[model samples]
Target: MQFENTLEFAQRLDKQDTLNSYRDHFLFPKVNEKQVIYFTGNSLGLQPKNAKKYVDEVMQDWEELAVEGHFYADKPWWDYHERLANPLSKIIGAKPSEITVMNTLTVNLHLLMVSFYRPKGKRYKIICEEKAFPSDQYMLQSQVRFHGYDPNDAIVEIKKRDGEHNFRIEDILDTITEVGEECALILIGGVNYYTGQVFDMKTITKAGHDIGAFVGWDLAHAAGNIKLELHDWDVDFASWCSYKYMNSGPGNASGCFIHERFHNQTEIPRFEGWWGTSRETRFLMKPQFEPMPNADAWQLSNAPILALAPYLASLELFDEVGMDALIKKRNLIVAYLEYILKEIDAQVESTFEIITPSNPKERGTQLSVFLHGEGKKLFEFLMKNGVITDWREPNVIRLAPAPFYCSFEDMFRFGQILKQGILEKNSELSS
Candidate 1:
């Protein structure tokens, strides 16, 4: 799709968008009773219009059936989480047996670590990117200390080279090769949370497995935003929250995946609970823990039917639109945003630099912009004027134009707002 050099081009793209009607499916925030151009889906997606109905169904089940709802509601609360597996699996590119929707993201991360982070005598190290999200860093540190290992010695962080904005894939591979023998697991985000850079999961998984190490991904920023093939990539395990691009509400339940190879491996120890017990004997009140023999065995408690309903609604939409269509739309929209931003930068004196990669395959929906002089003030100005984007620490402002709901016109308007902010800064100094 060639974008013309006029605002009409963006309007035309919006008209031509196949998923344009999906915008009305979401409830965007309004200022003065008008919809705001929301670009913060990377942080909190706009709520779906049908979210209330989804929640109401579960509420009705609870009201009508009470305790009986677990066994025999319309959807059967006992197996509520299972109904999500097929659709969630399609979003993450995995089989039904390899995925399960359950606990929150950090909680699920800990559970997966308990089962995967088996640190043997000599090989007791973990490798992750240096600027990983704080929650992940804390979890990794606590896990290492819990096993009586010093995080300073046991954790290896791959950092960007000097004067570089992002880490090179080859450097990551080299780190794995150099420390492969000592590393027990490679747990990194599928997309770097701060930089908006997407890593090559297949290559990373292959490198880790070549050295007898487990590979997992924190897909918090990747799932539903990018096209993933976790099963094809042979990723050993992965976890992600649904609130972001999935458009589930904040603090929504998370999803986890375990490759089919581990389906029957009873030797691996997990922190088990009654909910993960075999379905056939769960009611027998048995003394021993007979796990459910799949990824569901990692589940810890009864499914939160209320929390899982929003995901069901969102995943159904994803199934209808499909990832291929979303990704194609995303590439064009993101490239348009990048092209306009570069044009503005060139017109000015190179005041803003895009930290995210220019290549569409290397990023999903977000573009992290680094302003030269005054980033925070500009961000605050945009927020007060109703252009919604996220500000990371120091100098980065992240804007994600979600393909499912955002329009090319939104990107065009964002460029105008950004240019106005920069020009305003110049005028204030001169005045």
Candidate 2:
């Protein structure tokens, strides 16, 4: 796609977008009572207008039916989570039974690790990317400690070769080869939160399987931003928060996936609770844990219907638009953002670089911009101006133009703000 500089380019792209109507569906933030250019979907997605209505339905069910709402209310709180299964499955490309709506992202990550990360005597190590989200790093470390293994010895972190922002796939594969025998699992973010690099999940899964290891992913950044085929990729399991690109709101419940092959397998031990028991027999209060034969078997508690309703509403939108179409639109918008950023970089003397991969295939909707000097100042300036993006510690600003609502015009406007912020910072430094 040729890079063009004009509002017409963005307007034309918007005109052609099938999902353009989705912008009106969200409640964008306002600056001075005017809608700001929101590009921070990597942190929190704009709330869908239907979210309130969805929540209201659940609230009404609870109010009218009381405790009976569990089994008797409309959509039934008992099976409310199940209602989300098919739609969530569609977003991540999994069999319906292979996925389940459950706990938040980090908690689900811990749960998945418990079932999938069993390490035998020699194969006790787990491989992960360096600079993974703090929550994931903590989960892995705690899991290793829980298993009576030293994390420093049992967790192998793959870092970028001297001064690089992202890890190369070959380096990851080689690390697996070098440590594959001793590795019991590979838990990686599908897209790196800091660099916006979308790892090759298929290849990573294959490498881990070759080493007799279970492989899982944290799709918090990649879930709705990228096209995924977890089951087809032979991914053993995965988990993700819906609040990011899924637009489910802050602290929304997350979803998980387990390979269909594990559906009926009793060998994998899960931390079970009553909600995971078979729905028909659950009311009987049977002592034997008769888990549902799928990812639902991993559930440890009842679904939070209030937290989940918004996600259900969002998934319906995804089901209508489809992942392929969303990703196609994302590629164009992100490419436009990248083009504009490059122009800014070329025009300015400041040391700003886009750490995200130039190829759209290797990334999702985010661009991680690395500022050589005064990163925090530049970030603050952008935020104050209402170009809302997220600032990671040390030096990166992650901008994600989520396809569901973010526009090419938003990206262009944001680029202008970023350029202006950089100029201001340079002027301050010179003075």
Candidate 3:
């Protein structure tokens, strides 16, 4: 598909977009009076209009039923989180029983690791990328130290080659083989937050399993953004937050996937609670912890109804428009964004570099632009000009044209504003 760097071309594309109706479903922040160009959905997605109604429904249940809401209210609170499992299963490509909506991403990471990261004797090292998300880094470090191993020795970080923006898949495979004997677990982001590189989870999972190591993913950015088949890929465990691409809201509940192979195996250890016990036996007040035969056995506590309402609202959209539809729009729009950004890079005196993988298969909607000369200042310029993007450390602007809400015209306008900001900065330098 050819792309032209013109407003008319963008408008034409928008007119033809099948998912264009979804844009009206979300609430965007305003700049002056008009809507801002929101490219920060990779950080916090815009609220769905139905979110309020969902929350109110939950609130109404609480108000009317009080404690009876657990069993007899509309949408029983006892089974609230389960409502998300089926819809979420569709998005992540897993068996409904293999998925559960629960705590936040990092908390679920810790919980999943409790069962998966069983380091015995010499097979104690954890393999991960050098630049994992800070939460993952901290969790890995603490987990390694908790098992009485030096973090530097027990944690193997796969590094990219010098001056490269992302890690090579071959290098990742080689590292897995090299550390196969000593490695206990392999954990990595499905889509890297900074570079937006999507790892080949299927190949990585096979490589890790071949080496007698468990493989897990922190799918904070990948869960809803990319097409995932965690069960078919044989991903041992994975977790993701709902606020970002899932468009739940700020600090909403997250989802977890534990392969069915791990289910019904009480031999595997987990930090258990009453909620994890079988629903039939839970009311009996049995001191013994007989875990559920599914992924819900990992739940430490009952559902947080208020926190989950928005997530359920959002997942309904995901279930309505499957990943195939979202990815179709995602690739074309992202390509258009790439084309326009490259055009800006070519035309501007002060330039930016897109650090994300060029191949759509290796990325999602995110495009990380590493600004050279006066780029940090340009971030502020973009914000003041009503472009809602994210600024990373040093000088990278992470922009995600989220498929649900962002339009082709938004990409064109963003490019024009970014060029304007760069040109103005260059002029300031000259004067």
Candidate 4:
């Protein structure tokens, strides 16, 4: 389908969008007394109008029931997080028994490592992509150091080929084969935060396992933005934050998936607490640990009801629209966004380098573009003009048109704003 950079064309696309009306469910911030065109949902999602209602319900329960709210409240705070497992499993493609909502993303990664990242003599190296998210970098470094190994030796980073922006599948597979028996674990971000590249998880997981290594993913950007099959992929474990595409509030609870084979393993090493024990034996307060028969076995404490509230609310939207619908819109909108960027690039003196893969299967809702001949001033111009987006170092801006709330009109408006900023800069330089 052809796309045009006109308001009428954008409006017609919007009119035909089935998910278009759902935009009203979110509350967008205003700039210049108008709702801004939001492109930072990959950073922090806009607040759902219903998020307050979810939080308020918990607040009201706490006010009236006091400590008893854990058992007597409408949803029952003790088991409130259990509500999220089913819907979240659908989004991440796992059984309800394989999913659990718990601590933040990095925290869950640390806990999961206790079971997956074991190193021994002659088999201790861990494989990961180069320039992973800073938090994951820190986590890997610390974990390796804690296990009494030098990070420089224990961490094997798969570097991108010269003049390439994304990792080639063959390079990754060859790296795994080269690492061979010494590779203890392979953990990569499912969707690269910098380039928006979606790695081939199924093939990569198989490659890791064939080399006698455990495989997992940090789904911070992939969880709600793209389709996944963690169980089918035979991923040993995975974790994701809810605040981004999931539309939960800031620093909200994270969701995790642990393959069913790992469940109820008495010999498996993990950091355990009372909350991870079977519900029947939890309140018994026995000295010996009795683990749950599912992913909840990793829980360190009782659920944070308040954080889970907003997340549960967001999953309602996911359950209603489904990931299939979101992905369908995502493909078309991202394609249109790419078209608009190329069109605008041709008109302006500046060059736009889209580092993200052009293949729809290899990207999510984000387009990380390098605006050559443009500087932070262009980003500032955009921000002041109400285009909410993310800026990386060296003149790259990440635009994520979240399908649930972002519209084609937003894309059209952003192109206009971008062209205006470029032209204005050119005029000022000539003067």
**Candidate that would win on TM-score:** 4
> Model 4, stretches more than 4 Å misplaced?
none
Can you write out model 2's per-residue Cα lDDT over 258-285, one digit (the tens) per residue?
9899887766778999999888898899
* Candidate 3, run of 10 with poorest lDDT: 369-378
Residue-level lDDT tens digits of model 3 in 373-418: 6556799999998999988988898989999999999999999998
Per-residue lDDT for 161 in model 1? Answer: 96
Model 1 alpha-carbon drift over 4 Å, by segment: none
- Candidate closer to the true structure by TM-score (higher is better), 1 or 2: 1
Predicted candidate 1 versus true structure: per-residue lDDT over 1-431, tens digit per residue: 56654689999988989999999899888755666778899988888888888899899988998999888888898889998889888889999999988889999999999989999988999999987999999999999999999999999999899988988999999999999789999999999988899999999999999998999999999999998999999999999999999999999999999999988777787888888899999989899988887899999899998999888988888989999999989898889988888778876654788899888889999999998876588898888667888888889899899998898888887778777888898888889
The 10-residue segment with the lowest total lDDT in model 2: 371-380
How accurate locally is residue 389 in candidate 1, as Cα lDDT from 0 to 100? Answer: 88
Q: Could you tell me the lDDT of residue 29 within candidate 1?
A: 84
Candidate 2's TM-score reads 0.96
Off by over 4 Å in 3: none
Task: State which candidate, 1 or 3, has the greater lDDT.
Answer: 3
Give the alpha-carbon lDDT of every model.
0.90, 0.88, 0.92, 0.95
Q: Taking the tens digit of each residue's C-alpha lDDT, what string does model 4 give over 239-325?
A: 999999999999999999999999989999999999999899899899999999999999989999999998999999999999999
